[model samples]
Target: MQDAGFVWNAEELDAFIESPRKHVRGTNMSYPGERRPEKRAAIIEYLTQLSTAD
Candidate 1:
């Protein structure tokens, strides 16, 4: 939960993966989130591993 209002947690990640524009309006990004649910899961898993690494 880095952001005050929005926490980058699993639930939020699911929503974001579903649709980047819907998740955050007027978003500025070169490429939007993955269209495939499985791919999104992989990316999230990788991120979690990195985040938890000490």
Candidate 2:
């Protein structure tokens, strides 16, 4: 989900990152483990890096 240096609106980015589980219900994805926090943090960090990269 990292934008890889692409620009996106702050609201859109926040929605994607803080979206509720129900919003993702139809997707074929699952985070069923204790590593969920770590994984999510990694994604956020990656996206942040991409957003901040010049």
Candidate 3:
């Protein structure tokens, strides 16, 4: 979201994953969110791994 000045770092990613709409108002993301903290953490971890894979 360059227009919104949103950065995609881990901490921002965590909050955005928790609630897309709340984190970035007017977001088109339809998925509600991962309500469980553990699950969210897992998702973020998996994503991080994917991004770093070589």
Q: Estimate each model's TM-score.
A: 0.73, 0.41, 0.85
Candidates' lDDT values, in order? 0.75, 0.50, 0.84
lDDT of 1 by residue, 1-54 (tens): 233259789878877877777787767644567788888888889989999999
**Model 3, CA-based lDDT:** 0.84
Q: What are the clash counts of all predictions, listed in order?
A: 0, 0, 0
User: Candidate 3's residue-wise lDDT over 1-54, tens digit each?
Assistant: 556576788888888888988988888999898778888889889999999999
Candidates 1 and 2 compared: the better one by lDDT is 1
| Candidate 1 structure lDDT | 0.75
Residue 52 local lDDT, model 2: 91
Candidate with better TM-score, 1 vs 3: 3
RMSD of each: 2.7, 7.0, 1.2
Per-residue CA lDDT of model 2 for 1-54, tens digit only, reads 342334555434443455533334444436432235555566677888998999
Candidate 3 segments whose C-alpha is farther than 4 A from its true place: none
Among the numbered candidates, top TM-score falls to: 3
Task: Return the lDDT, model 2, position 48.
Answer: 83
Models ranked on lDDT: 3, 1, 2
Instruction: Put the candidates in TM-score order, highest first.
Output: 3, 1, 2
